[model samples]
Target: MQSWLDVDPTSDFSIYNLPFGVFETRDRAPRAGIAIGDYIVDLAVLAERRLLPLPDHAPHREEDLQRALNRPTLNDFIALSKSVTGAVRLCVQQLLMASSRDAHPPEVWAHALVRQRDARMLMPLRVPNYTDFYSSLHHATNVGAMFRDPKTPLLPNWRHLPVAYHGRASSIVVSGAPIRRPRGQIKRDDDPTPTFGPTLALDFELEMAFVIGKASPLGRPITTSEAEQYIFGLLLFNDWSARDIQKWEYQPLGPFLGKNFASTISPWIVTLEALDPFRVPMPSQEPPPLPYLRASGNQSFDIHLAVDLIAPSGLTLTVCRSNFRHMYWTMSQQLAHHTVNGCNVEVGDLMASGTLSGPTPESYGSMLELTWNGRNPLRLPDGSTRTFLEDGDAVALRGWAERDGMRVGFGEARAQILPALDGEA
Candidate 1:
């Protein structure tokens, strides 16, 4: 996996790494690109040049990648097996390596390829469905302690299963998109009546999302061992919530509009193969999971994740710091539980590891837990107190895995809050 290019061995773009994404230039439509150094290797141009050794039976064409990116679905591209992805990566690496005798000159590829700074990156895949799981034991326990007694920090079934709820895919946007303040019904604990208006308690949940690359038949279940083959990559996810709205509506069923507003994800999808170096042992369970959810080997990655809050005045504070290893249930276990009932999962479906909090107060993932459900306010650098997000405030999430001499990053996911709309009673 040697490259003649002067790519830093410490960089994310080693010859062994090929992460996928979608980008649009000022003139072109959204299309697939592979990260190589500071530039983006445009897949459409490479396919047109016949540089990639794609199988004859493969359904993808140069045009398909471009069109699929513009549409709302990434199923066609994700369905490609690992063999095809490997071939594409090898070809791109050879084309970029200067020492390869058969390689084309840099000038030839430069005209079609674009610098990452000049391109507008979009969500790598069009997700048809999304499910968020409460997989972090520390997050669940900390939150439970605030609302319930400390002795009953965890629900009885928390250890036995991966608790999850369906999420809205249409509201999921790529990083940098503005999150509009959602209007909802809010009831005060001491007030006699409820009021309808913009949400006052907005918060962000730091998590990771796994994209499904392969589909299962409608009536078939994917086993734990087979789940890895179906996974494509990982991205940083911010599951924004309206806490005040949620407190009023969450009763018999789970969240509704409170959780449906907007969720932001990082543009780049760091492939699972790229993260092999960071694999670590999962935490031991209090009560073991059922047979269907059990998995062997190191099931989680040691990804260092953090969240930063920036006010409109440019003051930034590092609020939460944690690792992906805190998750109680692994991605394989979540996938196994998802299909235990024979519910089919399609390509491009997203599974989010909800709120990755750790064991300490400094590592809490959301404002709800950090502020103790608004009982205490988070003091800011400007001497202001915040129970929830305010207009013009921005939230950013960053994650990476560093091992040996290489560092693989998921880039960053960021969003700024807009003032609530006017009129409309």
Candidate 2:
């Protein structure tokens, strides 16, 4: 589909991928925006002009629809039915088409379109809850070999169910935010006693997270076949980790201070409808999962994932190249398992596919696996080496799927690491 605007075919936000986010200009407040190439289509202005599909599934009053899009987050707008949001997406796509240029007034187009560079993209939603799942077999196997018996890498229950933990939704931030190195209890392999200080091993986990568009009642399980109805879209996620703290605190219980420090996500949420063409069959699961977790048809996306690290010296390096298709467990399975015990989910809740490491050294997702737990260091182009992140280092995660000359992507989830605070935590 050709847009009237000059959208580079190689741009992540091509006409085929109109991702949604919240943005604000100097004179405007936070409002809903649709990204296409280099511009942000303002939903508030479109609603005010009656160009968008308002009142069809939303408030009857056009002003009310405008007000809803003018909010600080997309949660309220997403709480509406999928048909409503789907209509909005289709309407915007139609308006941007080259053939439809003469159908709309120039004044209306001028007011509704804004360059992305002129606006600030904010967090797309207010997350009610966040769940992080260890669904990548390679990542789990690598971690197990490093810490557990190499002969028996996976735990007894791994192949049966998706292992996951509830993460801190409050700490999640939008891209370009700075991540402060967490200060916590650290006890190395040789240290007799645990000490409290800045983490010696700080890492970033490359992940893809899905947003829940609809809510489910408590005490009811969202079956595998029904899980997709609740999922809204996907976002690139960077779940930061403090490996030293994780090793010390994660025992009978799961991670605590080791995680929950901070995580970064791309501002835009790419809708599943935009990514439908790139769907692929999920990897076959051995020892077939229970009925509740069994899913039919294509359950995986062929999204290519990569991670780049910028050193303090200003050199950038591609440290990891992985794929979402390598995940052993699918989103359907994760959501089904999560609610099988009666855990209710809310709109805007996030569920992340844990580190998506592939079957190679360069495909490892986290520094823990890439550097083999700080033993093997990655040498950068500037001759500097990195086992884990240091102060002023920046990490960015990018994901995309392409076929038939079309690309749908999550632009970037980038963040710089800041020095620890003056005092200790």
Candidate 3:
């Protein structure tokens, strides 16, 4: 499909991938926008002019629809149900296609568009809660082999369910936000007592998180087949970690101070409809999951993921490359397991697929794994090496799925490491 707009064939926001996001200009307030090529189609403007298309199931009054689009976050718009959001996506897709150009003149249509460079992207939604799952078999295995017995890399219960922990939602930030290296309790193996200082090992975990669009009843559970319907979209996620703190504190309880500092997500939320073409079968789970977690066929996406390290010298190099399809536990299984205990979820709640590492060393997703927990250091272009992040070192994660010359992707989730606060180091 071709668009009348000047969208390069290589663009992630193709006519087929009309992802939603929030953006604001210096003069305008934050509001919902649809990404297409190099421009953001302001939904508020289209709704104000009655140029926005709505399905019969949507609110009849144009003003009501306009209010939903002009919110500070996409949560309200997402809560409108996929029935409404799905039609809106399809309408926006058609609005861009060359064959279905609207009857309005070019100048009238141009008023609703804004160049991507002129606007600042904001968090697409207010994240009410976050859950990070250890779903990657390879990543878990690597961590186990490094810190635990190499002969038994996996725990006994790992194959039965998705291991996860509640994350700090308030710390989640949009991409481009700088991450301050957190200071916390650090106890080395040789140390007699725990020490409090700036983390010596700061790392980034390449991940993908799905946004929950619908609220569920407190006692009701979401089944595997019903999980995707409740998920509005997906985004690239960087779960920043303070490895030194985690090693000392993570034991009976999962990540706390080590992980609560910050997590970065891409601005755009790529809808599941746009990613339907990239769905693929998940890696087989051994020992098989319980009845509630048994999901059939194509539960994982074939999104290609890459991580790049940007040195202080401005040199950038791709350090890791992996695929989301190799995940042992599918997102459906994660959701099914998450809510099986009657835990209710709401709109804007995020569930992240843990670090997506593949079988090869080059595909390891985190600095801890890529460097074998600091045993091996990665050589950067500046003639420096990194076992973990340094001040001014930035981590950028990119994800996309391309087929038949069409691409659908999360633009990027990037953040630079900042030195710890004064008196804290």
Candidate 4:
């Protein structure tokens, strides 16, 4: 957990922590690098140096490893067993750990690794399928209250198990991509005619998405015991929504256009192993779940998550704050349920935990819930009020786990709204 690199120990990127990512420089194509302070430990160059030692069971050929790194997907790389992952992390740490002055100088650790500013990061993995689950009781209840009576906040089945719907993977974009305003149908209760135009009720859902690295056969259900084996890591996700369109179409089927327009995810996949120390007890269930969804032990992660809204005029507001521990259902349960019907899950499939909201208003995960379905407008620093997102407004999601002198982080997922298309009505 130490590196020879001359990085501040307190920095998010440290030699002890080499989070892998895909990046490209002015002169180089996309390749893998380990974040170390202000620089990226170029894995392609490290491979050329034979500095990367593989675990005994690692897949053969540096070329395969390089190919996996260069490809848009991180699935192949993550499918490598824990032993292989550990070996690579250990070697990278040794190469960057501060060296003894007599043994070697700090500059000795510096190699062809490029500075962060000189490199551009790409999506860490190419997602094959995406599924978003409604796992947060607080968020679900708060949202349900807006449409249903407060006394009957949750649907009968909501407390029994996790509710999820498959989402479009093709529309998932990397952070920094512009989320073009989506167009859809909207009808007010009093309006005689429905209107089709850019969304007026655009918003962001703050949640964590896990990347699947291993596949399960068509008929086999992934047992809770084996769920972690299939998981690679987690990233912050912004499941952007168009509430207006959603309300009109989300009757017999769940969300379609409202939830699928443009979802955003952070670039780095913070490995599950790195987050092991931050594990917490899963929230208690009201009525016990079915046997397939039950785990003998507690399961959850203690990750702090937050969302910020920035106006076009440079004003920023900390909109929401919550923790992952608030989830009513575990990821293992969700995965088990997903495949209970003989559905095959492959590497690169992304599973998102729906808005991780807590109990208080300040912990609301989305503007829709916080504003009570647009009844209460959120006041911004620039003296503007907003019940929903406005064009040109940007939303950013961030998450981290802090404990025992270690900090594991998922970088921000940010997107700005563009004006809706004109003359569609």
Please give the clash total of every predicted structure, in order: 0, 0, 0, 7
Better of 3 and 4 by lDDT: 3
Model 4 lDDT per residue over 1-425, tens place: 54545666557664434677788888888877778778887776767666676766666667666666565556677766556656776777676555633354344445557998998888777788999999999998888888888889899999887899999999998888989889988887899987888888998998999988788889988877788888877889999999989998999998998888889998877778778888888878868888888885657999999999999997999999999999888989888888888899988899999999999999999999879889999998878999999988999998888887787777689988888777754
TM-scores of the models, in the given order? 0.93, 0.98, 0.98, 0.94
Name the candidate that leads on lDDT.
2
Q: Which model is ahead, 1 or 4, in terms of lDDT? A: 1
Candidates ranked, most accurate by lDDT first: 2, 3, 1, 4
RMSD of each: 2.4, 1.3, 1.2, 2.1
lDDT of each: 0.84, 0.92, 0.91, 0.82
Q: Please give the distance, in angstroms, between residue 31's alpha carbon in candidate 4 and its true position after superposition.
A: 1.1
lDDT of 4 at 360: 91
- lDDT by residue (tens digit), candidate 3, 1-425: 88888998878899888999999999889999999989999989877877676787665456667888999899988988898788878877777888867656787677789999999999998998999999899999999899888999999889999999999999999998999989999999998999999999999999999999999989899999999999999999999999999988989887899999999999999999999999987777778788999988888899999999999888998999999887899888898999999999999999999999999999999999999989999997667899999999999999999998889978999988889997854
lDDT per residue (tens digit) for residues 1-425 in model 1? 56555567656556556678888898867777888667787876767665676666766665654444344334566676665665666677677666683467666676656888899988777788999999999889987887787889988889999999999999999999999999988999998988999999999999999999888899788888899998988999999999999988888798888999899999888888888888999788767778888786898999999999999998999999999999989999999899989999988899999999998988999999889888889999889988899999999999978877677887789999999899766
Instruction: Give model 1's clash tally.
Output: 0
Better of 1 and 3 by TM-score: 3
